[model samples]
Target chain A: MRELEERIRREGRVLGTDVLKVDNFLNHQVDPKLMVALGHEFAMRFADAGVTKVLTVESSGIAPAVFTALDLDVPMVFARKRKSITLSADNYTADVYSFTKQETNHIIVDKRFIQPKDSVLIIDDFLANGQAAQGMMEIITAAGANLVGAGIVIEKTFQKGRQLLNEANVRVESLARIEDFVNGQVVFANED
Target chain B: MRELEERIRREGRVLGTDVLKVDNFLNHQVDPKLMVALGHEFAMRFADAGVTKVLTVESSGIAPAVFTALDLDVPMVFARKRKSITLSADNYTADVYSFTKQETNHIIVDKRFIQPKDSVLIIDDFLANGQAAQGMMEIITAAGANLVGAGIVIEKTFQKGRQLLNEANVRVESLARIEDFVNGQVVFANED
Candidate 1:
């Protein structure tokens, strides 16, 4: 977590009070070493959860989720943003609203991938309002699978995402929790 | 390569003459162990290429690209299909036609991630017509970076993707090349 916080401090760019741009290393352009370390950290935090699969959305979430799955020695299931031609007809679908895109898109996971006997750990690169995480949980529930917990790399603590997940009774672990952003400085939740 | 070929034969589904879906272990639900192995194979193939960065497109390409980057001990950059708030305004953009969706989407790569001295190896899940690879190459060219070659997990030998890359003077290595799909059987080009 210290490494993640330090990397964020050095590379993260804050715009206004709401957004943290980490495209340089976390999402658009990924640092594989950091990715492996983040995976180790997530696996360590959720080592006892008996996670069977790591679930995430498409695009940004795949890298960290793949690394986490590798560390946990499990498979990762990424929900596609849209149903493509190659995606099978048998799928558990859920609609998620993207505030960035300003539209609702349907995401899907094959029903056969998640089984009732499996326990899933939801993972993502960023958690702002928690809509994507909620959508993934719905897919897991649809497959009759158990969601042991949620793991996120960076979280905006000022938002209600953590509160929402906690109210849903899901144990959550985030490497970097942002407390607030003032002017150009980003304040971590645990920082004085 | 044998492991990948076995996986494709066992889990890959033939949708028709043109599409082979490997969502079970390659794209949608990814097997991390297999992913690591495939990454190792690609790294071995391009070991002497002096690959400083791994380039790919968003969504499905991120997983293998991440693993390849990890194996090569380099960073990976994925082009965004859509403009998001987090992506920096300074980027190199290209237009790619998606035959699956029947539309052209603009992909962007942050200019700062690629340097003129960088040697990039483009990585992707599938290579059919090779438009995605070409688009990625355009970004690399815009940055004045050298594209060492491309590493593809699956290639449709029946298609012109390989020919297109070869014509562009870009080297390509595809782990599994499908010659045809006849009566629900996959025919690899290398199989007798």
Candidate 2:
């Protein structure tokens, strides 16, 4: 966790007040070693939660989810934003509003993937508004699966995404929680 | 490779002419153990290629790309179709046509991710008509990097994807090459 905070301090780019671009190691480009370490950390943190499956949204969330799933020795499932002809007709879906893209897209998980007997953990890169995590939680509820918690790489606490998930009775464990960006520096909640 | 072939033969579903869905493991819901095995196989095949980076498009490609990058001990980069506010403006992009989606979308990679000193290996879930691979190849070319080859999980050989990449002088190594789905059974090129 300290290493992730250090990497964010070193490589994360803060644009305006909310956007933290981790170009050098997370999102877009990735360090696989770092990803593996993150996965191990998540597994270590939530080992007793009885997680049977790892869930995430497509694109940016897939890498960490895969590594986490591997560390947990469980199956990984990702919700899709883009509709594919090859995808089945039966699915559980929820709308996620992205402030970055300035749009709401329907994120879907095939009904066949999630089961009532499974315990699911949601993983992702960043949690800003918590819209994506909330959407994934809805999918988990729809499938009748037990929601363990969310494992996020970075959470912008100022954006109040943590409050959103906590209100929904969802536990969030972010490796790095950014309290604010002051003078082009990332400030962590626990640092000072 | 044998295990992959077995998985495709067992779990892969044939919907129509070319729609082979491995919903149980490959896409949608994924088996991390199988993915790790597939990654190891790909690494074994391209072990001597001097791969500096592993490149793939986002969503479905990210899982295998992560595993492949871990096995190769290199960083991974995924091209994005959805625009994000955090994403940098300077990018190298290419238009990729998705036959399943019946649309062409622009895929982008940040200019700083891929460099001239890099030797990129494109990894993906499938190679149908190879448009995605071609688009990724263009991104590698834009960076002035050497393209080692494409490591594909599955290839519908009848679709002539192999021919296209071969014509472009890019080597392709598919774990399972489908000759065709005969009588609802996946037929491999080497089996016959």
Candidate 3:
């Protein structure tokens, strides 16, 4: 967790007021060693949750989630994002609105992957508005699966996403929690 | 590689004539241990290539590619797929046509991640039509980076993708070379 926060402080760029660009090591261009560390941390944090499956959104979440799943010795399932919704019987779908892109996309998970007997853990890159996490929670509920908790790589604590998850009684754990972006610099929470 | 072949035989769904749905392990619901094995195999195959970086497209390619990069001790860069193209000066973009989806999407790579002195190794989930690989090659070329080779998880030998890469004189290593799907069964290229 310290390594992640250090990497984020060193390599992450602050864009505008709230956008933190981690393309160098977290998102677009990934540091696999760092991802492994992050994944191990997440697995260590949720070691006793009875997690049978790791769920995440496609693209950005795949790298960290896969490693987490590997350490947990469980299957990792990524929900596909579709710009246009096509109603399907085989999948449990939820609508996720991206505040940055300003568009609504449907996140879908195959019904066969998540079962009623399974315990699911959600992993994601960033927890901003919590729309994506909320969507995954919806899919997990629809599949009759038990939600263990969420493991976030970088969380914006100033945003309303944490509040939303807390309201739903979802246990959320983030490696790096950002309190605010002050004058083109990141101010992490609980950092003296 | 035998382990991967065994997985394909057991869980892979041969859909129609040319489509092989590996959503169970390689794509959607991923088996993390299998991915780690596949990634280790790829890393071993390209061990002597002096690979400074690993590149792949987003979503499906991220899991295997990240592990491959980890084993190789390099950075893994995933090209972002955009349905609508927005030309930018800071990124190298290439158009990749998905034969299955019947749509053309742009794959964008940041210019900062790829350097002219870097030797890049492209890794992907499938090598069917080779459009994604070709696009990555184009971006690597545009960036003035040296391409060592490509490591493919599954290759359809019957498809034109292999031929295209052959003509381009790029060395390719596929873990599982699928010859054909005969009556809903996968036929390996070099089965004894």
Candidate 4:
């Protein structure tokens, strides 16, 4: 977490009021060593949760989720995102609205991946509005699987996502929590 | 390589004559240990290439690319795919046509990620039509970066991808090379 926070401080760019671009290491251009550390942290935080599977959305979440699954010695499932919603009998689908993109996209998970016997942990890059996490939680519920918790790489504490997850009764662990972005600089929550 | 071939034989589903659905491990629901092994293999293969960065497309390619980068001690960059092309001055873009989806999506990489002094190695989940690899190569060329080669997790020998890469004079290393799918069974090109 310290390493991540340091990386964010060094390379992260704050655009406008809330947007934090960590393309240099976290997403887009990834630092694999940092990802390993992030994944190890998530796995350590949820070591006793009986996590049978690690679930996340496609693209950004795959890097962190895969490493977390590796650390936990479990299978990682990434929910596929579709621009247009398509109903399928073999898959559990949920609609997620991205506040940043200002568009609604459907997230889908194959029914065969998650089951009633499995306990799932959600991993994501950024927890902004919590739409992506909510969608994964919906899919996990539909599969009759137990939700262990959510692991976020970079969380915007000022946003509604953290509170939303709390209301849903999901345990959340974020490596780097942004308190606010003021004058093109990031203010982290729980600064050490 | 034998381990990967074994996995393909056991869990891979050949949907039709040509399409091999490896959603169980290679893409959608990923097996992290297997991915680690694949990445280690790729890293060993390209260890002498002086790779400064590992490159791949988003979603499926992130897992392997990150691990490969980790083993190689380099950064990994995944090209962002856009449904609608948006020309930008800060990014190098290439149009890739997905044969399976029958749609063209533009893959973009920021100019800051790929530099002229960097030696990039392309890593991907599969090599079928070579569209994704070709697009990455174009981006590498545009950035004036040195391309060591491509490390493919699975390569269908019967497809035009291998021939296309060969024609392009790019060295390719594939962990699992499928000769054909005979009656829903994968035939490896090199059976050791």
**Model 4: which residue pairs collide?**
none
TM, chain A, every candidate: 0.95, 0.95, 0.99, 0.98
Model 2: pairs clashing at backbone N, Cα or C within 3 Å: none
lDDT score for residue A166 of model 4? 100
**lDDT tens per residue, model 3, B48-114:** 9999999999989999999999999999999999998779899999999988899999999999989
lDDT of 1 by residue, B11-103 (tens): 889996778989999889999988888888899999999999999998888888888999999999999886333445688888888888687
TM-score to native of every candidate shown: 0.96, 0.96, 0.99, 0.99
lDDT of 4 by residue, B9-65 (tens): 999999989999999998999999998998999999999999999999997898999
Q: Model 4 chain B, poorest ten-residue lDDT window?
A: B183-192
Error of 4 at A52 (Å): 0.4
Q: Put down candidate 4 lDDT per residue, A134-192, tens digits, no spaces.
A: 99999999999999999999999989999999999999999999999889988899864
lDDT of candidates 1 onward, in order: 0.90, 0.89, 0.95, 0.94
Expressed as tens digits, the lDDT of each residue in B107-192 for candidate 2 is: 98888989999999999999999899999999899899999999999999999678999999999999889989887889998995
lDDT of 4 at B171: 98
- Candidate 1 docking band: high
Off by over 4 Å in 2: A83-89, B82-89
Candidate 2 structure quality by residue, lDDT tens digits, A1-192: 999999989888989877889977888898988988898999988899999999999878877888899999999998888442244569888888888978788888889889999999999999999999999998899899999999999999989689999998888999999999998889998987
Candidate 2 — what's its lDDT?
0.89
